[model samples]
Target: MSNIIETKVCSEIGDIEGVILHTPGSEVENMTPGNAERALYSDILNLSVAEQEYKQLKQVLNKITKTFEVKDLLTEILEINEVKESLVNNICKSENVKPIKSSLLSLESGELARQLIEGVPLNKTTLTGFLSDERNALRPLHNFFFTRDASMSVYDHVLIGKMANKVRERESMVMEAIFNHSSKIKSKTLNPSSSKHHKDEITIEGGDVLVAREDILVIGTGLRTTTQGIDFIIKKIKKNKGKHSIVVQQLPSKPESFIHLDMVFTLLDRDKCMVYDPIIMQPNKYQTILISIDNGKVKKIEKQSNLVDCLRDLGMPLEPVYCGGKKDIWIQEREQWHSGANFFAVGPGKVIGYARNVYTLEEMNSNGFEIIDAQSVVDGKIQLSDYEKYVIAINGSELARGGGGARCMTMPIRRKKVDW
Candidate 1:
């Protein structure tokens, strides 16, 4: 077995050292059009095409850093009898599938892991089961491929998600179990569910939180994350007793595209950021608030002029790259819907995003970022180190339909601290 993996994430633009990924599997294809909305998907994905597209991301990440698969890690820990029993018990109880406990415990670790994620089919032998319209005794995790949503690593601790949707609650439970029991992972887990201040409305998803720097956290509050959720995060920081800053951007509730902070804004480097102009830059009903915490207390709380201005005031001046381009608002709206602003930084000035956003890529090119195809890097035709600043564009035609981009799909566990 590999040595226990300690978690650490101090910056968004640092060189990634370790990351967790879940390749699209049957769990993704398990959903039907009827349940797509509940699954939080705008459209159903073609499994074959999605897998092909995902391979580009997986292969690119594999070449760059140490990558771990959730299933493999889950199976590794499930091999421990005590951990296995406790995890299964917790899952069955939390998910209201206690009837399957003995059966789950009876299976081998590998098979059990598969069933847990892909779902266990309902027997339908009993009268209640036969009469019920349910398809599985346990629901398949349809959105597991977007690993960034369930749990997030922030400066050595894993924050287990308190999901906004009941359907995704199991994903958090599964992730918490992995971080808690996986022999390969060594990290303290903070679960809002266990928090004394937690309430039904206090839900926070990983997609809404960004570790911009060791002492700075940029968060979004909207449909997915509530004020109470942000409050829980504030309490956590206060307990730590240090100078901490958080820039809270209020997101729109109407468009499903504005689901998280990363959807509209993401840090690309120590001095660069990508933003959708309408909400982030332009004056709107949604406000940006900055809160400063020092010496275990909130030193100041006030409304900020805007996300960009507030960030600059925090001493992290960033040059903004418009999502689609600076010319047209129409194109910006279209491309932002397709996740044009969502870029995942593997290192400062080194990132990955979709190539479909031609105008956005052009803007990046104008900003001196070399555009490289992910396939070229994967095939060894071009070395990534050859370019100091580059964007490896992956084909996200199919994956983008899943309503996320490179940043939304990744959950970076450990990153080398940036020399700011």
Candidate 2:
């Protein structure tokens, strides 16, 4: 039998070979307007509509490459008694629900996996449980569908997320468990929790880190990721002897839409990138800095003009496609808030994003990208291979309200090398 999982992601625009996805479950419906903000959601999503839109992306990916579902992977890992006990213990400890450890241990792998993600209902038999205001022993992972945040695959290793929010920390724990213990995967996970360098102030998420090339990384620091987190990544890169570069873009702390780098900047192709000009290109108080590592030691750290200019100076010049079009900043800000800038590359020049951003799609069409509806591709009405570069537009009116796009919902593990 062949190994199903081999981690290798050197570039954002490589030909994707294997990726992980988590179809939104009842966990999404498990939220209420009262606590949605605490869950990092501005608004509760219509799970039915979101699932329909997600299916198109899922079907297209399934047809193009190998795809794994989180629930399935978790189920497989739980079959091993030792792994099951260990994961349950870690979760119980992290959430301060040690009393539920024995209860969770008794569940079979399948049910346990479901409860872990969807949430374990509180047992009202006990006096404390009955009197408690909490509705669950384990709160639902409301943001798990945006799988990109919990764990990141970077050059043969997985960097488990150190979530900025306590509510989402379990997301990282579950992802780390899946990658570390799943028989289907074949790579080691590097968790900040295990590092002596780990500190409560350090925070990193997949959305803020992008592998521009094998030796170059683009990271964002703001509400979701901290400067300390970038320092941790630099230390990790120093362990390997090579010339490496990390471009750090400081983001605004307000407007939750600017939560991560991917929210405003994402690679669309080897020579093309999607960007929100206000943050990535235009002059602003936020600074863009570059750190260079040579032979396992930092050689220099200096400020750069902007993200686009910095990349150009680094030898990979990308044609900027403004999100929500360049005609007006008001339109750009509006669509940017709705996740118009987020795009996920399936191949060198092929990508996927929300179709609701009409201005952005028009810009893509004007710039040599053929627009193809995701539903048509899923229904066999069109063939993706016919176009050399095209954008698979998925319906996301409801999903975008959840604060992410295709890139946020999927985590790529393996990709064919990009020929630049």
Number of the top candidate by TM-score? 2
Error of 1 at 242 (Å): 3.1
Q: Which stretches of candidate 1 lie over 4 Å from their true place?
A: 1-3
Per-candidate TM-score against the hidden true structure = 0.98, 0.98
Q: Per-residue error at 66 for model 2, in Å?
A: 0.7
Q: In candidate 1, what are the lDDT values of residues 148-202, reduced to their tens digit?
A: 9899998889999999988888788879888988767788999999777657779
lDDT of each: 0.91, 0.92
Candidate 2 overall Cα lDDT vs. reference?
0.92
Estimate the lDDT of model 1.
0.91
Clashes of 1: 0
